[model samples]
Target: MAASKKTLEQRGFHIEVLNLINPLESMSYNLLQLIKDAYKQGDTATAQTLCNTLSYSLYYNPNVKDPFWNNSAMSLCNALILAVIDKCIEEKTEDKICMYTVANMLSELGSKEIVIDKQGNTKNVLDIYFEILPADSVAKMQYATSNFAKGGTTRGGIFSTTMSKLSIFTFEGIAKMTSRNSINLKRIGFGKSIQGKGTPRVRVQIIFPDGSKESIKTDTEGRFELNFKQKVKKGQRIHVMESETKKKMIVEVQTINKDTGETTYKVVEKQDGLQIENIVIFEKPIAVFMIVPDYDSSNHVIASIFIRQLYFVLSKYAGLARGGKCHREVVFLLDEFGNMPPIDDMGNIVTVCLGRNIRFNLIVQALPQLKMKYGDASTTIQDNCGNQIYIQSGNKETAKEISEKLGNQTINSLSRSGKGLSIDKSKTEGIDTKPLLTPTELMRFQEGESAVIRFMKRRDNKFEKIEPFPILNRGKTVMKYRWEYLGDDFDTDQSILDIDIRSLHEYVNPRDLIIDFFPKQEEESFEQPEESNVFVSEPKPVPIPSEEDPEEPQFADIDEDIEIPEEAYASEPVSVYESEPASPFEPLTLENWKHKTAEEFFETHRSIWNIIEKQCMRQWNKSLADIQASTMETFIDELKILVTTGEIDKNIYRLINGKYGEVMDSLLEKEGVKEEV
Candidate 1:
């Protein structure tokens, strides 16, 4: 019997242990099951609550062996709690939640609360933490205790704020004594404030050694991880600009101290380039002149009068030098350009110059003497007689000689009027037809028009007239046209006009087209019309009152029978006889009242009787004239009753005295309180 009792006691003790451990475990199992159901069904808050209960239960579990159990359970619970919290956060983004505490809990947890898709087979929560820092004791401890609350530390770095179109400019200088280069440029993520979608473009400009500038533009997302693209040196300046009309910003370059690791950055101030005006630059000087003759001078007469007369026709080309690629300061010219100095002693050339880019050339209409005196090879072929133009020439030999020199032939005799025969470049057949000139040669050319010329073909030594392309001696090129420069004869330059050469690619933000929803407009157009018949329908109508009532007393019996005349009763109310109540010439004054209280006033003017009774005025007064003017016998009697019943107080007397001063005067005269004032 003793042996059997001992065995029974041992069995009961085992059962007691099982019971003690099972409830906590069972409760946790039930809570987890409930949470799993909530999580699967999308009941996030319920899931979070069940998780919290499980965590608390785990904390209290006496038989629990894992020291990390509370943290692990709390992490799972917190994740669900935070996920429920995250929804609220996403909705209320500005709300603050303990991210660090949550992170700590997750780090302590050995497993993650998040589920992974089976097919993709992503790393679970614990896997993520382990992958980042497998040997990190603190992190491992956090995960073990808080269930993966630590998360992947690699991804956890900085906090973001709500600022749209965020742009960051990093300024750093490597001060450590080493050969390593450290300065880099980059754009971080959008600020937390950047809510919508758009292609944000960031521009970076770097000013390096020798005052040279380099610029690069970033793609969408405002993210640019900078590595060394070029050599870095000392005294370099870097600038980054965020170019959005709504969020225009400039970020300055900064450097961090090596020892302290302290960094500083300043907001950059940008100047508007377009607003700057009248940019001017000094250029070298060149000569400009029109070849006109001293026609009447006999001593200076040339062999051909027509030759001298044609000088002006070719003088128009003088301005061509001013429009060339070389910069021109000024164009100085007489009849000849060869007379000018080659170079001034100060290292400045003695030729005309414009901006650094303008083209410069010299033009000269010289006689043999002038050519022999100052002409050089650098004077340009066109400056010589190569571009010489010929008009009417009386000498056939001179004309033939000129035509031969120009690679043209004499067609006919010059003996006839309006007809001259010579050979020159034929613009039509790309050959030197060497055609003779008529009145057209003497006419001035318009701006849009140009003269065509067939130059003598030098290739193959062929005597052919080649029609060169009609060059606008004053126009510009394609590149110069990109930037608009609006002034002078610059219109002729192709370089000055923005001609379409290629299709344009523009980066545009998508949110510009989105419609904002706040403060939405209400639609009032679809209101329901009221149904008149539904409310108007009556069930039945009463029959007309019997004609008998002769026995009933007439309403007239109650009325005062002392009517003076029908005309008197029919008369318009005395208010009609009076002009519309005159506007107060001045503010109302109590000095106008003769009566002590308002009751006397209503007794006089019954038109104001309702007002007196409505105001509960016990003692009222009115001017004598006003009392005589209205029917007030009933009003006075009613007011007297109110006073006798003790309804009138000193306050009422004061109110009457102050508010109805004009009416009180008549009442006072009737009462003989005092002479009307």
Candidate 2:
């Protein structure tokens, strides 16, 4: 379980269990636990509840305790689940869970490249779900349900998580057959001969319905049985091939009902084999050790499914026609029973499952808590309980009920009347009815005091009833976890431990999902605000001189303008500043600049116009005058903005800076727009 690892690990038990199957992928394991298993046991109600597990994506009213309140909504969700799963299995695109495996597969952008944003982030399956599904759209799956639902949904998220984490319904060894000695292992072997290629022991592979393959070996006689990691069905194709050479002995079949359908492959005649039966390998069912977290609210939601299904499968097998009752008695010790998710047919399980040899001991703090989760069904559960135990009663309601159930007994009392009135005396015995114990008396029960009420006894079908008895305040001994009380086999609570189960978020390998748009080349450079000039994508940044030094920083103040003829740039253009010498394009002439608009100036002159635009949007109110390059890079920013905003003519500061080697200008100089000293 994702939760409860810490608590279990604290007791020197670190369990890292993840059966998470991506919902977008076809389940390789049994699907019966979710649907068919229940129907087999004639539990249609539970079968439908299991169906609700797949309805995680659907909207549910937080107020609705009953998930089936909106039958149409539930049906729509179930249909989607079945549809997606069917498609995923049908497509079997690497049998991987992804957008493409389901209804909203993202198409590969040319060559195998997946589209990414400027941040290099790509969309996943969850992204598409959120993009199309707006919870508030056809909403009010809210007020329609009871307020017992968690977070405006009837445990939908947990339902999704449970579906994701399923592999074999109830752990590997937990599922049992309907009959004690029932098994149908259909083993199919390749047509490999004892004298075939190499040794007959050489392995052959079987490709599953999903594109994944597994190598299965042939016996000494070139005989082998059919075994599959995934559940096999009638029509699904299974490919047989040689193991080492990666050769398939498969071919297209002519007859498969539809003549126009995609060509289906069959094992080559040499690879085909006969199926042999009656070779059985039975494994004893093992115990399930599940640890759930008490802290998280969703723990109950997750755990409830496991408990419910475990009971369903176990009880179903026990009640089978060929199965003997009480062959394997399964006992459930459920702690904090009231907090667990409300299980379907829990009342029926408690009363009816006794014959199936399954038992459940639900421990809760109070009767009201159980009633809160189970609602009206609590009465059935409580009434059917064979023996109810109370170690100590603090709950007023539970104690009152216990006191009432104890009933009253008639008590005989003798009274003697004697007085100085005529020396006469009389003694009489009378009986009166009084409760064995009052609610107040039971509510004050002390530590170790307890009572057990056995309601009825049933030998086979006949029932024997018992009269109500007093609520006894008998002493009970509790097993302590102290070192003195525990043996060497047990661990004490002196030291605590933990194991973190959450792994790194990075999961998908980009290589599996993408091909590089372009082959490897020189790394591209970006012009960050403080790193390089905005005009160029790659250029030396203007440096600010420290006040302590007072010396000019490189390229901070250019004393002379450097000029070059138009012919010099006719070949490969070079940067005006030598520190970074690669000019992407030639600067426009003065006449061209005068005609260019602000947008044109910024767009043509700057590679990072967007960054400049952002800065300019904020600088409108700030004073751009008298700010020198020595103060900060803003001084250069002001020069660029002045020309771009058309506040001054001819970009006077750029010419004075001598970086662009601009021709001298006088009109702008008259406006006192010269470089700051």
Candidate 3:
């Protein structure tokens, strides 16, 4: 009984054990009483039978059944189902249930069960489900745990606010350090006061390098500080102009420390890369920090916050570099990347950071996780990566995608046919295409094995070319690192003091810095007005020549030698050079052709009218009126001469009449020649 009680306690069945003990106690007392009665009645057989029945009942009590105590598949299934139900109840909420919520709950339960049985008779329920779920689904569940769905602004609000404050503080420190020609003050105070009070507000204007201006006012203490939300880069000048009249004076610095027996005198110099008094280091350096959560941690909300803060800091550094080459390369190796909140503008960074020597090595369990978080943008993100290494994947989809990307190769296929009785045989060869690596082969790769697709930019024939290469190799083996176990040392001091806070506030003067950029008044220049002499010239009228003047030759006199054949002007115009009389055709005149409603007029006159219009316009440099005023006799003479010389075929009229009669009429009308027939 004691052993059974201990086992029940070990298996976390304390409640069941208590219920069993309470019932068994009463049963035991009743059994003793019954045995005594049987003995008194001289019935030994009844007492023995009663004892056996009670013993069997105690051993096989259904109420005290423990799944952990049983070592069988059936017990394991029951335990898993009950565990899931318990988790569901514990995490019940008004919001719609998500797959990730269930997955996380199941994972936690599995962990506890594993602790209870180091060598379980069945596989873990969480592991089984993980393998079954698609990669993207798993990724989304992991992303939800980081609380990124709350929106980027909300998730990163705290970090952004804190960084803004720090940047303002740092800017003030830099101003103080760089103010070489400023007056030193023994003490300075900045305080805000109620409006309409005794203290007066002073307006100050700040002009950024980009020509954007911001106006601010001093507090009751005549001191002011500017807080900027956007990131500020190095060498970005800020011009401060005081609205009120203020005199500028150079300040000197002198320090004496009686306690340290030291005396110092120095002048601040104009320079860049000013350090933030104590917290931040201005020099470039490599840094690494680990972000780990406890095994049973509910979510990675805190870790995600830290990561977001780090991203902002890196972004500031990148901004300082001004999108140019970075002084040093910065690389972020994010392990279990899907488990963190999505970083803002991560896609932009991935696409452009490589040129600035900034790189991100994101490690994920599967590609689906990435796709879940990025959605359609997942493809763009993957495409921008210069190199991709795909290790063995249990996911058929992932393997297939990778295999297809590896490309296809042609192979020889052979086929043979034979009939034994006829002794006839046939053979054929064909070409077939298949992927470089089959999906099955890709998935079957052993541990430490990977297929790498590297896009290398190399100069070929003086031109840069990007080519991809597939490489298969085993990854380097690494030994596990461990530290010796040690008990807590209460006496040891682990505190670190890296910077002195006293020096930060020693020489700050917001008032003097504000006055440094005061607008200076320039003397206005007044020159004597130049003497003005008015000169007006009399207007002269130019003579206009009349069209009928003898100096202007008539169209007939311009080319009078050309002659037109009588047949060309006959009622039915005929080609003069043709042996047979030309077929009757339509006129090509501007007015008659414009009114001609026939498709043939357009087809036949289109080319000829184009030529005539171009020639008239070029010869006279005149408008459409000049083309109308020209004599039709001159055109008819030119057409006859062209036909006689065979330059314009007479058969052209016959063909135009048969195929496009109205076109021929439009052409003749456009040339100012009347089509009588």
Model 3: worst 10 consecutive residues (lDDT sum): 184-193
Tens-digit per-residue lDDT, 1-677, candidate 1: 11222333343311011011111111000112233334545556555554443333222222346534334444444443334233323334212122222322233332323223324333444344333333532223323433333444422311011000011100010001000111100000100011111224655443433445444344464433222223322233333333443333333325543222233444454444211111111111212112222442211111111121122112212222223322212222233333332211101122222222322234333333223432342333333222344433344443444344434344533322332475443333232345333223323333332332334223334756555432222343212332354333233333212221111111111111111111111211111112211111111111111245222212222226432232211212221112446532221222322222333333333433343343432133433344334333333332223333334442333233222333433333434445311
Which RMSD does model 2 reach against the true structure? 19.8
For residue 170, give model 2's deviation from the true position in Å.
22
TM-score, candidate number 3? 0.32
| lDDT ranking, best first | 2, 3, 1
TM-score of every candidate? 0.16, 0.43, 0.32
Model 1 lowest lDDT segment of ten:
162-171
What TM value does model 1 have? 0.16
Rank all candidate structures by their TM-score, best first, as comma-separated numbers. 2, 3, 1
Could you say which candidate leads in lDDT? 2
Candidate 1 Cα misplacement greater than 4 A, ranges: 1-338, 343-357, 361-363, 367-370, 373-380, 383-402, 410-466, 469-677
Q: Each model's RMSD to truth, in Å?
A: 43.2, 19.8, 41.9
Model 1 local distance difference test score: 0.28
Q: How good is model 2 by TM-score?
A: 0.43
